[model samples]
Target: MLRPMGREDMRAGDSDRKTVADQLKTALDEGRLDLSEYDDRLQRTYAAKTYADLDGLLTDLPGTVPVQRAQVQPHTPAAAPAPQTASPARQIAQWAGPYGAVIVVCVLIWAITSASAGHLTYFWPVWMLIPLVFGVCGQWFGKGGPHRR
Candidate 1:
């Protein structure tokens, strides 16, 4: 009985050659292969007759798909990622850092501008602090507040 043709043994077509040529061009662009090696690989890729032949050309190049490698493998469901829930204190702390940074940066900008022109600039950054205060109040006094049993 004649054995069935395996994937590697299958004859490559023009499209297959074109795909390999594109991959080789990418390898050249990434500096993985110098101009001489790229030219050699490009020539060999066009001259390739089978998938196995094409596979050898890109075996050492990074990020190029192996021509003979199986496209699909046995599927196994991956474990789901764990959900994240932070405690009130942790949530408050997380909220504080970013807001504090914004406040500090704004205050610095205000001071610098004030000094630059010869007097204190208006403290406009106080407006930015309103959201931070409300966020903290919600975390402490809202339905999910820490004090609720």
Candidate 2:
């Protein structure tokens, strides 16, 4: 019969080393270890050959429970509720709000310039408005539009 696996003699892998490295990084971020100490521990973590070695590095830290086999639970089936689609008006409002703000700001600048410069010049804001209008229209009518959701 096969025996249960034990942690002490388990071989450490690259992912295990990376997990330890990430924990060390978090500790360094939280002021638990200085740069030099963190660097030293990180190097040792990558060099660790077995689970025991990895466990030793984290022994002083809180919440570092040794890895164990996950307990399996019985599976059950329950249908999840379907996601509700946004109303066409809601989607239009969402897409329009930012674009509307950009158009407004551009028009305000153009108007202020025209007033200062004695007369209305080229309707330069139309350049900004055209592409935004096209995008909004595309989003409203395209195959991948929000309404399709």
Give each model a TM-score.
0.45, 0.65
- Residue 42 accuracy (lDDT) in model 2: 94
TM-score of 2: 0.65
Candidate 1: RMSD to truth: 6.6
lDDT of 2 by residue, 1-149 (tens): 98987786789999999999999998888888899999999999999988888877866776565565346579998999997877656767787888889989999999999999999988898998787778768767875476574
Please tell me which predicted candidate would have the highest TM-score against the true structure.
2
In model 2, the runs with Cα more than 4 Å from the true position are 1-6, 25-44, 68-82, 144-149
What's the C-alpha lDDT at position 131 in model 1? 92
User: Best lDDT goes to which candidate?
Assistant: 1
Give the CA lDDT, 0 to 100, for residue 31 in model 2.
Answer: 84
lDDT digits (tens) for residues 1-149 of candidate 1: 99998988999999999988998899888889899999998999999998888888878987765744548678999998897866777878887888899899999999999999898778899999999999988987875577774
Error of 2 at 55 (Å): 2.9
